[model samples]
Target chain A: TPFRIQNYRTLAYVLTTLVYLVIGAAIFDRLESTQESISYANLQTRIDVFRQQHNMSKSEFENLTRTVESRLNYRKKQWKFIGSFYYATVVLALVGYGHAIPYTKAGRAVTIAYALIGIPMWLIMIQSVGERLNSLITFVLKRIKRHFKRKREPQITAMELLTCEALLTVLTLATGSYVFHRYENWRYFDAFYYCLLTLTTIGFGDLVPMQKDDYGSIGWLYILFCIMFILTGLTIVASSGNLLILRFVETNTKRSRNERYEM
Target chain B: TPFRIQNYRTLAYVLTTLVYLVIGAAIFDRLESTQESISYANLQTRIDVFRQQHNMSKSEFENLTRTVESRLNYRKKQWKFIGSFYYATVVLALVGYGHAIPYTKAGRAVTIAYALIGIPMWLIMIQSVGERLNSLITFVLKRIKRHFKRKREPQITAMELLTCEALLTVLTLATGSYVFHRYENWRYFDAFYYCLLTLTTIGFGDLVPMQKDDYGSIGWLYILFCIMFILTGLTIVASSGNLLILRFVETNTKRSRNERYEM
Candidate 1:
């Protein structure tokens, strides 16, 4: 029924993911253009102003570029570290590392406040992920029930679970290699590695595929590549998420039966 | 029989996750201290450093403090933006943006090489997550078989799923809020926001709660939280994985039969 609780919830999840994905893509695309502009005349103007203010000669200007480059490099590495810190924190989901922000009291106050807003935002996200999962679980359970309804040992040996593993490997390999080919010249093993990292989202940023020489022309293609990568990542996570839910139900069910029998 | 494959795999998962949590916590604690030291000089030495670097009078120093404070505010916000970028890259499991790294051809080459390395590193991780998932699936399928082997249906229903959800929620909340309270004076909601972000690894770092405080004082506690939160996440994923496996097995069984009948 259109109003069934599960159906309604599934509809909501579909709509939300679709909406968020579109919004996210839009924002990413806008940012990509903004980043492009940051290098255009505006940034050149800012550099010229800074150099003039410093009363720099051409040689001094070059020296200053070296110094600035060094500083930028240092900052790049530092910021990358911070970025990695963010990656780790999020993966660990601790959200406690303050290296990404101020450590002062006023800063802390704002941080605390932002966190208050962020918490529920995350909770909403979790609920959405859970709802998606619930829908999936419902879908799977129904399928199993239908199979068992046939009322036979059904000539199915469960060892075929290994076959699923085989299928997963093949799929992972095929998809991984294709992505790798488009982004890099990795061998099969390396392609598999890229797939692993991208799918899992470890995202060290140490191993990102660099932006190609767009020659200012491939920007749209690059954007498309990124957006496609994000969607592919969601699929991998969704599949992995599906696997994780299966284990949870199994463990809990056993624990409960054990407790009851013991009682 | 003494060393069942399923049991061994579960043990491996627990051990790997346990080890990763330890290393993750240790690194974070050290990083916190290093970052805290960046602004430190003891209150007395601070005067000397300020005098030495910029040659400021007390009044001038105080005035300069305003500039520094404003700069810090800007930096904090900027860092949070960077952190958010890193997070977006991580969760999507694909780093597309070139914020803190090279965007040139040389840079792309580096990224490609780096990705080649990163992919396998990620694969190893997937294998670990995969192992845990496999055991969990086998464990659940065994249960389902026994469940149907019985004369009664055991009243399988949605209520049972709630029990798992409750555990996941509690486990997340307990670890999340505690770590949040570690460095920030956030309300419980703030703590919760921090927790949800951390668990899901969405990691919008605008509200980092710890670091620059307590170093090793709560090191063990921090580690414990990481272990618990991720385990809970993994467990939830496992439950769904089990359901999907069952469904897949059923579908394949049916499809193969249908093809044979048509033939």
Candidate 2:
């Protein structure tokens, strides 16, 4: 019966998520579909004007458009050493920005092989670091409590660690946004969006940083900083998520075990 | 000392992974960079020829190219109800195909808010489903073993479970590839690559499905099937990864605890 209850509970969660996704889909469609149509029409008009200006036939215009589109996609040098390294990190992190994807068949094959091993390795590494970070935070919290001469021995609860992680996440986002704003010359809001997307690993690539041909100077430093920022931010979030999920599963298992004992 | 050793081992893993990434980057660069340059040059030549043929000035051609690129990006109707649902699933999974990202500021803002809550909830739900899947497989394997009437009790080992999971994953890939190959008209290899990328959640949108306006009569069926395939594939992979990481962490923790006890 407990097993059945657990299955039922999971089913409920799945149903709820489906509803949530539907609501989100509706909201996104409402906010974006009209804008998408307006923009699409504007682009169509522009293409039509260009065709008329050149006295070009439909087939000729289509051919030129195909050529120009492919050319525009590669305007930036995305396969150089540094960019390639960036691509490697993105793949390992499962961020897959699509800004600099593998263009050749061999590249795709290698990507598949590389990701098969790299992703799990990366996950373990980040999560290992995250656990350590959690311990370090817990130790520091305990010391702070001791310094305050608290009446209790100051055992750090999961809730406390969670709050600490949440704070660190916000701090990381704020600092990351400011840094990207300065380096990438994006508006602050856009930079914040970029940082959030990267941390979540959603990485839509709409506003990827380090994309310009010229980073002025200290480009390597900026790139290194960005990579480190991504790694470190994910660790913090992983720690937080780890705590949340483990506590959740632990509670559920404990409840079910107790119920079984009662039965 | 054991604590220090654990830290050192984690550090070693981190360093090794860095080296691995560097090697991969070199390989990818070597494999793909020359092609990139060749393609880039070819595109440039075509653009130049087109500009000269049209007697278009530099600025005029630049403006036209920008409009064409923007227009080309939206040739697909990616904001319809079904497409939006697909988009929602991608974001929630953090696959982020980027085929149909939010256009308006409101959409982006809502996306941020939605992901903040939805991502963790989705993670928990998927992991729960994955755990159940794992248990179900183990149960079935035990049942099959008992049917053979072995001398010893049919105990399902972790290794056995792992092998089963691997076989299931490969089978999922094979069948998924075939189905997508039939439906989306992609080459078999490309369909396999799509399945691999989707399962890894490193969804490079270069070969996203459902892009064509004409999906024949069973378009909705195809869409539903694709979504189900993605979810099931991810759940299987998550189950495998979960077993792996938990076993790894358990062994490490056991060893360290034993070392502490010895001290």
Candidate 3:
């Protein structure tokens, strides 16, 4: 019953975060839309001034303006509903791809306030999921250990644990690379590099998948799964690293104690 | 003696990380420079082709090329030594400002490899520093408690700790805002927002400071100091949050235990 209550609490927290994101998206859209329009107007004025200075014909001026407008339009497209949602996700996760940034002062303020609350909420959500994943990992490891015991093998050592962690990390990297190579049309090495960068949360934005037009509907699903996978992978890797450090410290302390006793 | 050993060990780790960063920067610079030259040549050829096709005069072509070259140079500046160092710091911190991304495939791969080793090293450095800072904070708190005791006041409670954390956060935000507003020539609110965004490690990259002129030699030092301040601030806030969460969980568990006994 308590476990159920905890699950419910996590669900509530998640739902609250989703609601906040939706509201944030709407606010960002409104704030940024006004700024975008003002900038567009300013661009038009600049184009007009340039056209007059050059004494360009209407058709030539139209061509020049069209080129500039299209460039601006491409940028503006990133602030739409779905794009804003993606931006909010990045901000909450602290990945901050920096593809779409707030232009208005109000937008910046709201963004700061939103992140102040949103990041912790996001962390809580990730922590809950990570805890569950950790439990599952432990269960699997225990089952493997039991199997080894039944086979009359030696007990699992710290070295074995370290090896297992290293193997998992390599496997995760390989699998991620394979998937991204196919989806993003990248080279195998680039895909692996992207996976490393993303899972580490370095997200340099040089190679973001799902932004290209080719993937379409599947892109969204792939991105969702990839994010979850990355988060889970990071949690596992961090825990393993922590365990390794703990073991090393424990051994050092024990050795030092023995030396003190001998003295 | 162990504490002294720890201090030495931490120093060694710091030096090792610095050495690693230096090597990484050199590698990145060589890799990126080669790629940049190739790209620049390609751009020059394309510009030449366009100019010839358009039958432009030498002066007109020069003007066009100059504009394009200036834009390229602006981007190229970010790959310079100081900028690369900043980029490295952001990547290792998992902040990923998404400015100055690696262009070459080899560069990307090297970045991934570098991060795999670098991030954990960076974390260890931050952790060691954070522990020292935490001890310092505790010592200061104890002194304040002793002062209160001398005044015959009530003992400090968890509530006071929470209040102190809140006050420190506010003070940090205000001080950062004041400093950055003066440095960046930004409005007070924008500076405050920038501080929040950066310290939280969201780093949207829309508003970067110290990249401008006028600050000169001090800008580098200021950036270095700001980064240290942000890292220290993050550690303190995280620890305070953890403490708060632990207290809440303990209270809930105790309440539940009492209820179970009653039942």
Best by DockQ: 2
TM-score of the second chain, each candidate in turn, equals: 0.39, 0.92, 0.59
Could you tell me the lDDT of residue B232 within candidate 1? 47
Candidate 1 lDDT by residue in tens digits, B40-144: 434336456535554446775444344333223222221133233332323332323212333233333434454444433332233334333443434454467
Distance from true location, Cα of B254 in model 2, Å: 5.0
- Which candidate has the top score in TM-score? 2
| Pairs of colliding residues, candidate 3 | none
How close is every model to the real structure, measured as TM-score?
0.34, 0.94, 0.62
lDDT tens digits by residue: candidate 2, A72-143: 679788888878888999999998889997878889989999999898889878867776777678778888
Could you tell me the lDDT of residue A220 within candidate 1? 56
> How does residue B214 of candidate 3 score in lDDT?
53
- Per-residue lDDT tens digits for candidate 2, residues B124-173, read 78877777777778778877888897635677788898899999999999
* lDDT, model 1, position A142: 45
lDDT of 1 by residue, A1-263 (tens): 32243233334543443344344334433343344345444545654664465455667544434333323222222222333333233343222322243334443343344444443333223323332333334344445655878543333222343344345445755765776566566566556555554554443333434323332466555544543443334444443443453344344435443331111
| Candidate 3 lDDT tens digits, B21-66 | 3343343333333443454465556556644655666686444333
